[model samples]
Structure formats: structure tokens, C-alpha cells
Target: MDASSDRELPSTQEDLEIRAVSAERLTFFGDAVVAIALTLLALELPVPEGSTNSEMWHSATSHRDSYLAFMISFVVIAAHWRAHHRVFRHVTATNSRLTSFTMYWLLTLVITPFATDVIGGHGAFQFRFVFYAVVQSAACLLFLLMVREIPRDGLARPGTAPEIFSRSIHRAGMVALGFLISIPVSLVTRWAYVCWIVVPLVDSVIDARKGRTARQSSQD
Candidate 1:
């Protein structure tokens, strides 16, 4: 009895399997949600209607705003999914917080199509534009939270380098900042769209410089 009382138990193989399964399920679910959001965006696309070639071209041109909104949303969702794929690959465990954050992130993704429709609609230009920007920014910020949570909560696989997620966090933050800055700019003029285009270029340059600096520091 005394010997039995002194024995300690180790984690069972089944427990480890469950953890891996949970993480995989979460990732698969996220991917599915993202796919649906993208499909929705396509479904809502404005169909160019006309009786002749010239008419069809004019119709398409008339709905240019709708087409532009669709393009922007499609890119945004694709980028978010790519980043999600990158971070979730390192995740080997799941927790309540991760699940909650992911669900909220997906919510933003789902709302993107609706926001695109609103942005392309007539009237209330600033309000509609800001609404779309806010949605995109929320998606970016939520993803940043997920990236940080993965490593902070020890969800990543053992021996994984912390640096693996550092770049992702930085990218997410920069994208979010771009969207946020555009909000105020939207109030004054439509030139705010330039932020979305310019910020990534700037981030790329910064990232390259940082990489060089890191390399030099390591050499030193």
C-alpha cells in the first residue's frame, strides 16, 4: 500500500492524442469558416447585365465600386487566412481562450462580405468606408492576439522557436495600424485607400532592414 501510494503517473498517450486532435480540429474549423466567408464574397459580386457588348461593358463600369470592394475583400480574407495558416501550424494544443479568440476572428471574416456591400452602396460615403475599414482592422488585431496567445500560452510544439511568430505579430500590428489610420483619413477624402496600399510596402522595407540588422548583430 505504501509503495503504491508513492507511485506517480505520467501523461497518457491518449491525452496527448486528444490535445493534437483538438488543435487540428480548431485549425480545420477556422479554414472552413474562412472558405465560407470568401465564397460569400464571390456570391455577392455584382453581376454585369446587358443586351450587347457595349452595354455589358458599361454596366460593368457602372458597378466599378462593387468590383473594387470585392477585390479588396477577397485580398483581405486571403491574407488573413494565410496568416492564420502560418500561426496554427505551430499550434499543438488548444484552450478556451484560443477558441474564443478564433471564433471572434471568424466573425469578422464573415461580416466582411456584408461590409463590402455597404461600402459599395450609395450615400454615406465616409460612414460606409469607415465601416469596412473597421472590419478589416478588427480581423487583423484579432489575428495578432491569436499569434501572441499561441506562444504565450505554450500552445506551440515543444522546441519551437519563439522567433517563428515574431514576424507574424509585427505584420498583423502594421496592417491593423494601417487600417486604423485610414479611418480618420476616410473622413476627409477617399485617398485613405492609399494607406492600405502604402503601409505594406513600408512594412516590407522595414522588415528587410530589421533582418539585416539582426544578421549583423548575430555576426558581431
Candidate 2:
């Protein structure tokens, strides 16, 4: 090849290498963002205002709802990070579209603390519950989109199992469905938070059944 073609080839190859590593860069950035989000969630809990031990205990007891909200949100964010890590583990490359979706997903992740505070401070308000549910559901939806996009964009490494992708999508969808359902349910009753538990509970039963069936099929 000519000198110009040789130079162009190296430049193109360099660009491709950068694109290949983009997913890794994004994953690291995402990990940092999630850590920061969890930290912010903890920071939402206030120090007990009273100076004396008994009085401080009273003040702490008064904010039990805040602590509860913080714990729940922390678990949710940690679950999100785990799911994100699992999906990205198969991803070998990234593009503008994937990056954009990931950024939007992280935006929701970052907003989670604010939503938690809203619900913690105004737990009695139906709208506050709905707002928090909506934020979480949006994050789940965006994550689902990114998971689906992986195979479509050929981002997954060769030989990755189809079942892996399906399960990831299913889990994310179930969580999103739970939150979406909770939104309308919140309007009717203050106990709508219970709806969130349905996702994991149902998912566990379904997973158990699938495991049994797989073992039977293998034996046959």
C-alpha cells in the first residue's frame, strides 16, 4: 500500500481500539457514579439533634422512616449496579447510542437519592411515592433498553449465551413492572410500597420452576 493508505489504516485501527475500550471506560465511570449515589443516599439521613443519649435516641426513633427509606434505596441502587455489571461483562464494545442510553440511566441513578428524600420527608403523600416509583421505573426501563441494545448492536462478545440476555431483560422488566404498577396503586392506598416486593418474590418462584424443568430435561 501507499504511504497515505498506510497512515489511514493505523488511524482507523486506533479509532477502533478506542471504541472497543469505550465499554470498559463507561463501566468504570458507572461504578463511580453508583458508589457516589449510595454515599449520597446515606448522607440523606440526619444526625440526631438532641445532645443527651435519651433525647438523641428519641430523635433517632423519630426519623425511623428516613432510615428505612435510606436502606431500601441503598439496596435498590446496589442491585442496579450488580445488574449493570452483569450486562456489561458481555459487552466488548460501545457506541454513541449505548453511551447515550447509559448516561440517561445514570442520570436516573443519581436522582434516586433526591427521590428517596422526598418520600422519606413526605411519606404520607401519594404523589411523593409515585414520584419515587417513577424515577426507579425509568431507570429500570433505560437499563432494559441498554440490555436489548447489546445484542442488536453486536456489542456482546462471541459465544455469549442467549439465555443470559433473556434473563437480564426479564429481571429488569419485572422490576420496572413492579414500580409502574405501584404508581397507580399508590393512589388508592398508602400500603402501595408492598407492591415492590412482588417482583422479587415472583421472580424467585419463576426461577425455581425453571431450574426444576432444566434438571428434568437434562436427565431425560
Candidate 3:
């Protein structure tokens, strides 16, 4: 047989297998990057260097902003990781577009540590607040894009529930909106972080009501 005749066209199943491998690798790399980012955030905490107990106490207290920043960023990173896991769980295959979105999202995750450090070292500055908010908001938006892209890109598994996808995207959008709003709010008041908590609280109440309605409908 001629060389041309001997060549086999790539099968759909083969393509899917390659995509699945790529997606798994991407997720593994994403997990590693997130782990590193969290470590970098923790490292931002200053060592309480002092010879006396009183001096040590003063040093530790002085770094209160760093500690607060570390806690907040840690929680934020953890939330993002959880959301990422949920979204990717439904994804059976990936395309270049989805991969691109994942890369951008990971980029934001990597940048988060620097932003956290800025806020930790200079939390009082409006610029720092806005910068950190922007970084986190970008991460949220990218993840939201990925969540939406999965179904749109035809990467979602056939058995995946549409409601779960919708809820994931909605939650991500809400979180991103909160961060975006906090940017402008930060300019006006130093209490802008309150905006972040407000959105989630409102979402929780709405989700609870939805759950109740669903239960009542099932009972009926």
C-alpha cells in the first residue's frame, strides 16, 4: 500500500482521549499553582523578631494587617479552588478555548499572592485595596467564563445537571460583582471589604429559599 493509503485518519474517540489527558494535566498544574500561591501568601507573614516578650508582643501586634490579609486571601484562594473543582468535575472534554480560559484563570491565581502581599504591607492605601480587588475579580471572572464555556464549548458531560452549571456560574458572577463593586466603594470608604461579605450572605438566603421551594414542590 502507498504511504497515503496506510495513514489512518484521527478518530473522534482518539481526539477525545487527547483532550481528556490535556484537561487532566491542566487541572493538576492548576492545583500545583494554587498550592504555591497559598504558600506565597502565608510567607508574607512577618516573623516577630524581638528579644523580650513585650517587644515580641508588640511586633506581632504590629503585623496584624499581615495576619488579616493572610487569612482573607487564604479563604478566597480556598473558595476559588473549591469552585474550580466543582466546575471541572462536570467537564469531560476540553477545547483550546476552554484551555485558554483556564490558563488566564491560573494566571490570576498566581498573581493573587503579590496582590495579597501588597495589601498586607499597605492595606491602608486605596490603591492597594483596588489592586487586590481587581486581581481577585479577574480571577472570578475568568473562572466564571470557564464555567460558562464548559457547556457552551460542549465540554460538559452528558449526564451533568444544567442547574448545577447555572448555579456555579451565578455564584461566580455574584462574587466577581462584589469585588468589582468594592473597587469603587473602596475609594469612598475604608470599609469596602464589607461588600464582599454582603453578596455571599444575600446569595445564601436566596439559595435557602430556593431549596425550600424545591422541597415544597416535591411534597406537592
Best by TM-score: 1
For candidate 1, write residues 95-116 as lDDT tens digits. Answer: 8988899999999999999999
Comparison by TM-score, 1 against 2, better one? 1
For every candidate, C-alpha RMSD to the true structure in Å: 2.3, 2.2, 3.0
**In candidate 1, how many Å is residue 185 off?**
0.7
Rank ordering of all candidates by TM-score, starting from the highest: 1, 2, 3
Q: What is the C-alpha lDDT of each candidate?
A: 0.91, 0.90, 0.87
In candidate 2, what are the lDDT values of residues 76-180, reduced to their tens digit? Answer: 999999999988988888978889999999999999999999998844688789889999999999999999999998888889998888898999999999899
- For candidate 1, report its TM-score: 0.92
Q: Which ten residues in a row have the lowest lDDT in candidate 1?
A: 4-13
**Between prediction 1 and prediction 3, which has the larger TM-score?**
1
Root-mean-square deviation of Cα positions for candidate 3 versus the true structure, in angstroms? 3.0
Q: What lDDT does candidate 3 reach at residue 114?
A: 84
Tens-digit per-residue lDDT, 40-76, candidate 3: 8877679997999999999999989888888899999
